[model samples]
Target: MKQICVFILVLMLTSCEYFNVKKTSSEAILNEELQTFNWNDVDVYPTFSVCDSNETKNEKTACFTQVLTTHILGYLQNKSIVVTHDVTDTISLKFQVSETGMLSLLNIEADSLIIKEIPHVKELIYCSLDSLPKVFPAIKRGQQVKTEFELPIIIHAN
Candidate 1:
């Protein structure tokens, strides 16, 4: 009788459905989703009116930069700021384009002599940037985003 009772108890425990567990596929699903995720690289470069009709990304970027450089240089040259005493130097200006297509000056780097010689250099840079044509901000993941630009201004004094 004891042996028969032990056998019955073991059978009852094994036959219960509560002891069964199933594996979930969450790991596999997560891996698949990650494979389809898009990285944050810019899909489109910022555009100026001169670059608006460009067909390719590289062309648009190049044209935009060239046009911007021309505008800034034109302003400086017109103001007679590039004339110096036989010294050649480069001033690096960092700026940004907002999502709403406005230019803002961020920072500028120049030599001590250049800083002393150039009156209100920051103001001049701000004015130049303010004079730029409206831009179409860079696009990332199909949304407009602010972008930074670094421009090198080379002053060649003869």
Candidate 2:
């Protein structure tokens, strides 16, 4: 009887041994990775992947501005995109993201052929970072969080 009990105990221990434990669901994993996705381009700031701690508002603003501006300049620096030295206008870009968290290039600059083809520019990646997913990182009880951000870009040619 003692041998039988010992055998049963050993069997129970071996059967109960865990291989691996997965607490997070598939949806949770997909959502987390989707929220923290990295872009193909490295110049764009304010990306979901480019959050900087202890950064001042001015620093953030400057970083994003420089990123977008440099990208645009790189696209139009020497290439044959003719810009009117006299015509200067501030074009506003707005987007309406879908439930899947994607930045659809909603508004287009309908001024010229060059303007319309901006999306095709090698460096011209849309503001994917501006439209962050709802699954963005949430601050803990004592952690600092950014409440609001204005992802605006301005282009100038002179």
Candidate 3:
């Protein structure tokens, strides 16, 4: 009876180890979370103060676009650009908004003809960007993140 009791106690202690759950490492959990996370999507887009905060994501986006376009167009319109030939082209502006809400030009895509016609076109764009209203940085996973934008502006001057 004494031997049987000892064997039973040993079996019970060893079986407890079998029922223990395996602990997951923090790095493994973080890796799994990152793999499931969508890197391309943002929780909130960069916005201007003029944009309504209560609006939906799509509305906020539209307001941002409209405000940005208006500001650029207004600046361009104020400039006295005189072209010899009827100039019509689409200018692609690539820019970035930093995590701190600063705007910086990345690249400008314009036809050679447009460049020839408006020698200071790049300068004008830079000035316009500099004059933009205060912007709010985009948010991803509750953290401010930098975002890049490519805007196409159609220019028609006679």
Candidate 4:
């Protein structure tokens, strides 16, 4: 019977593995998602009360940077730093903002010449960061997350 043969062929094709929908386990799905997720990128950057919260990502970043730079420069400028030699170097300052909005200095990288010229530079930077205003932690997936920043501070002293 032609109808019976057609039904048999259809049944055979449906029974093949290629036609079956595979079900993935939740754990496997989660693993895949984690693999594809970008850990370095955050949905929202950390902000200060002075920064506009509704700004775009780039604007938020700029606001944060400007605020931080202003505060640090202001603090440093208040102190009279006298250097014997004309020194021009960049200091790398690595710091972190905790999930609870606490700022902590991780490390400071400065050239030997700069360090020799300004022996108390590290202490000044530490004190400056300690006096920073309240910071808001970065947001990732609507959750507060800790973030690290490395800012280069150029020192030009004659």
Predicted model with the maximum lDDT: 4
Cα lDDT tens digits for candidate 2, 47-152: 2334355266456546544554455455555555444454344444444333333434455443453364343532343433333333222232333222223233
lDDT of 3 at 116: 91
Candidate 4 residue lDDT tens string, 29-124? 999999999999999888898887656998888898889888887898899999889998999989899999998889999999999999999999
Of 1 and 4, the candidate ahead on lDDT is 4
Each model's lDDT comes to 0.79, 0.46, 0.90, 0.90
Question: Residue 130, candidate 1: how far off, in angstroms?
Answer: 2.3
lDDT of 2: 0.46
Better of 1 and 4 by TM-score: 4
Off by over 4 Å in 1: 1-40, 82-84
Instruction: Please give the distance, in angstroms, between residue 122's alpha carbon in candidate 2 and its true position after superposition.
Output: 13
Give the top-scoring candidate (TM-score).
3
Q: Candidate 2: give the clashing pairs.
A: none
Report the CA-based lDDT of candidate 4 relative to the real structure: 0.90
Residues 28-79, candidate 3: write the lDDT tens digits.
Answer: 9999999999987788888999895656888887888888878887898899
Q: Which residue pairs come into collision in candidate 1?
A: none
Error of 2 at 72 (Å): 2.0
Q: For residues 11-98, could you state the per-residue lDDT of candidate 1 as single tens digits? A: 9988886777876699988898879876545688788887878899999989987888888778776776653556467989887878
Q: What does the lDDT read for residue 82 in candidate 2?
A: 45
User: For every model shown, what is its TM-score relative to the native structure?
Assistant: 0.70, 0.34, 0.87, 0.85
150 in model 1: Cα distance from truth in Å? 1.5
